[model samples]
Target: MLKLLALCLLTSLMYVQIAEAGIRYYKWEVKYEYKSPDCYKKLAITINGRTPGPTILAQKGDTVIVEVKNSLMLENLAIHWHGIRQIGSPWGDGTEGVTQCPIFPGDSFKYEFKVDN
Candidate 1:
């Protein structure tokens, strides 16, 4: 029993240490712009003024910090991390009216979370 207990405690400490080891940060800006996706000019929601937004590249156990700014004149915005597991940071889920309020036009919000895959 004593040996098992010591092993369990050591395993838990190792897990915690590994989780806190590799963390990276990032920032992104969301903006509204006019673009021609199919040769037709139209207003589109974009990140950094580009359609389709920017792709985030991170390894497991990394941290990301995205600073989103709503530049639209009349629209509210929120961002969601589709496949990233936000384990302990539920408020950064970006589900407007659920996890957090919508970011109004001309306003900004910062999302900080660690990626756990």
Candidate 2:
């Protein structure tokens, strides 16, 4: 019994450490709003959930993982990391419909990229 418990504890700790490796997270808020019948609010167009979204802080060479969660009902959204010189990494540039489509309501899209100095 003691050996089994020890093994379980060890395994759990290892799992947590492994999960923390090479993973960075960025969160964004999406408003369920509409201006027209087809057009929905965009990331760069919105400010930190307002008009311009928040500017995320990350170090060069760090792996960035952006998780965009949509709360609105509209479908097809996209976010772009404008002016981020990523050495031709397309995932970091959050361009909707170009790199990856926007996440729908209650949906999430994980955008991962490594920063370069």
Candidate 3:
């Protein structure tokens, strides 16, 4: 009986560990605006009106959800997740005119995918 109880406990611990595998979530809002990074003043497309867009930091096995908003007046926008191998999720690849359509001006799109290494 004692051996059976020990085995059950071990099984329960293993199940818990599997259930608690590293899983994370992130959200971002992307926009376009004009900005000048250097001394020269010029109009440049940016995220959230900033020169440099927000950086996303997540561990392996984490899931990210980014909501891109195209606030440009006369330009269509699309976000690309470069270097991210979106396994099992090809729709979130963000390839303009390829995986998805261009997000029209004043429109928004959500990108959901997992960061599996």
RMSD of each: 5.7, 10.0, 3.3
**What lDDT is reached at residue 101 by model 1?**
90
**TM-score, per-candidate, Cα-based:** 0.75, 0.54, 0.73
Give the clashing residue pairs of candidate 1, or none. none
Model-by-model lDDT, in order? Answer: 0.80, 0.65, 0.75
Report the number of clashing residue pairs per model. Answer: 0, 14, 0
Off by over 4 Å in 3: 1-32
Residue pairs of candidate 3 with colliding backbone atoms: none
Q: Candidate 3: lDDT of 66?
A: 78
**Which run of 10 residues does model 1 get worst, by summed lDDT?**
20-29
lDDT per residue as tens, model 1, 1-117: 999999999999999978765655556566667899999999887788778987777666677778787887888888888887678888888888998799998898888888777
State the lDDT of candidate 2 residue by residue for 1-117, as single tens digits.
Answer: 999999999999999765654546777767643233237543333423554466666666567777777766665567766666656567546666666566767787777777665
The most accurate candidate by lDDT is: 1
Two-way TM-score contest, 1 vs 2, winner: 1
Cand. 2 Cα-lDDT: 0.65
